[model samples]
Target: MAGRVLRPVGVITETARRLSGANLHERIGLKAPPGELKRLADTFDGMLDRMENLVGAQRRFAANAAHELRTPLAVQRAAAEIGLAGDPPPEKVARIRTRLIGVADSSEHLIESLLLLAVSEEGLEHTSPVDLAALAATELAAAEPGAGPAGPPQDPTVVRGLAPLTVAGDGTLLGHLVRNLLANAVRHNRPGGRLELSTSADGVLRVSNTGPVIDPADVPRLLEPFRRSAERRHTAGEGAGLGLSIVASIARAHGARLAAEANPGPEGGLTVRVRFPLPEGPTPAPDSIRLPRN
Candidate 1:
């Protein structure tokens, strides 16, 4: 019979280590009375339960917020339409239209944030087979006119995906993620700055923009809710800063990796790289083949 010899971990009790796991060294192995050890274990379980409850509450709040905003936006938009049609002075109508636009924009932002949170929290409900290259092209096309370079437009760059290039994730959330990245780039860029977006076969999508340099220290903080750089805070059309955060959260939930870095340019700015999880195995057969024309 082989007798187990447990090495004493600093500040740990021999009995507790045996109880937790023979091969384990943990803070919970601290010397304590038998009753106290049981109490500590109980406390740990209680904390985990509390954490789960808190997460549930947050999800409910997101769902509720999304549900609540839809009605108000509809009502506000209708009222604005009526106001526009009626006999209001040009000056007054202009003011009214501007204020209404602000309201509508605010409401829309709120709804979008809530919906993004809800979809990410719910887990895989709104997902479908998505082509990152196609999505990026579509998103770029849909951006506001005069957003990027002017004159005769250049053709969009495309990266070939290995397979159906499909991943199971919410299409809306993904689109929002792409849109936010593009919008952020365009809004913060220097005049005539370059924007590049590409998707790879290895399940990575990258968006890069040329703009003023963001401080290295600001990268992590940039994703926090309502946190924006001082430079961007005063900028026109600045968002709540949930855009990148939402992208990060959704990436995490989908078991993907989200990375940020400074892009290479005369005036460096932020570049976001998101690596989505590839479905196990190779690209679909039809998608993988290069056909010969008849």
Candidate 2:
């Protein structure tokens, strides 16, 4: 009887000692007879599995972040090196200045995106009634001045479905979500492409853009950090591939459902829709309002 108890204890000690330096990827688990000892072994194994998953996720995130940040830094370094290499004339200095400014702008955008992503990971702390439709309109309007001739069609049409489509969430975060969506829509669109923004009484917000067709299979990967679709390759330096990922993160933080669908046609485009749960209260009247055609 004494040896029986001591034997199990001895086995547990030896198992733990052997596992101390063992590779976490091996998924090694202890073997014990049916009883409290078996339950203990199972619990230990489960913990190891969870730790492995967490470590793996952290490693991936670090790798992706390093890769994304290196581009702008490299651009900045090259610009500085070229500028200092010679006594450049006024025209050359101006050109170099412009290049540096572009690099600076890109760096600023990347930092802001990284901060937003970090905040999203922490989750939302406060919530209130927010008018997503109005927010969408405001963001779209703010984006107009930056929408150059090379961007989406000038004077893009606007179609409003439901007025005061309110959702319960952090107003600032929700604004960021809307802005990112609208920015992506305009940024990826063709010159003559059309953008449509609409909201439903059911608490659904949709932004659709007529641009390069995206593969349905690639949509999932596009939402991951630092992952971009084939269409984005040509416009590589314009963005750091965090727009949609940040949008997805904010949506998740707000407990909203986000879905991306490819447009139906050979020309190809993408529509992103986010649906939020209705707050407790009377639903607003559904009205169709269309802005004057641009």
Candidate 3:
């Protein structure tokens, strides 16, 4: 058999193009400049880099979440096994029960953290307009540690906005956002420490507590999932390192902004300020939309 061999041909264009026609031969064509190929290659490279970072972040988040859950889960299982094996002394049983409660509480906390994260990631499409001042007040009331045996009065700093400023986002998630900030502040503060929260007319909310200064270097790192500063880890109470990360995620989801700084006041500590950009113009009252009451 006789065959004819043809050499490869080159084609170039100023811009990308695609052509379609009834005939199969003319159905498809794309035009591009010489450098377009290189530009495309660069774009592919950038996408790969972004994908790598996303995958790394996901792996790290999963590992850290597992580690955080394992401690409480292990304790809960052990406590259950002990109870099932035999009936211990009343005192011993009570201690085991107490330990089990702590484990259960930790589990609940983990679930709450996961829920908050999921909701924030889902974006604010489902959220209605929210009044930050009212939301903050409600969160503060619910976040109180409750009265001590002495019945010490608990007063949270409250700031009422000039008008009912509304933000388009999930109120429950925003409440969690506020609560997380307040909880972290209260939990990490010194004994008898002071907490102050303020809401500006421009939809900015600030929460500050008196405690040790957060090292400047650790500020950004603290916002990563499951990351806790060495100084923060020394403070009282069990923190799963999800606090500021949740705050950051919520802010991003809602197009809100968050700011943090070290307070120079005598009652020095880290201050976190979340500034929510007010929706343009008058905020129409949401019809039949309500946030979950804490």
- TM-score for all models, in order of appearance: 0.61, 0.76, 0.72
Structure candidate 2, residue pairs in collision:
213-268
Give per-residue CA lDDT, model 3, range 7-105, as digits (tens): 101221221133122221221132334455445544544654565567778878998888777877877887889674686888888888887887787
Backbone clashes in model 3: 1
TM-score of 3: 0.72
The 10 consecutive residues of candidate 2 with the worst lDDT sum are 144-153
Q: Indicate whether candidate 1 or candidate 3 has the larger TM-score.
A: 3
Candidate number with the higher lDDT (2 or 3)? 2
lDDT, candidate 2, residue 275? 87
Off by over 4 Å in 1: 1-93, 144-164, 231-235, 264-266, 282-294
Arrange candidates, best TM-score first.
Answer: 2, 3, 1
Report the C-alpha lDDT of model 1 over 135-157, residue by residue, as the tens digit.
Answer: 77788778744533543253223
The candidate that wins on TM-score is 2
- Model 3 scores worst on lDDT over the 10 consecutive residues at 3-12
Once fitted onto the true fold, the runs of candidate 3 whose alpha carbons sit more than 4 angstroms away are: 1-45, 80-87, 145-164, 231-236, 264-268, 282-294
Q: For all the candidates, what are their Cα RMSDs to the real structure?
A: 10.5, 9.5, 11.6
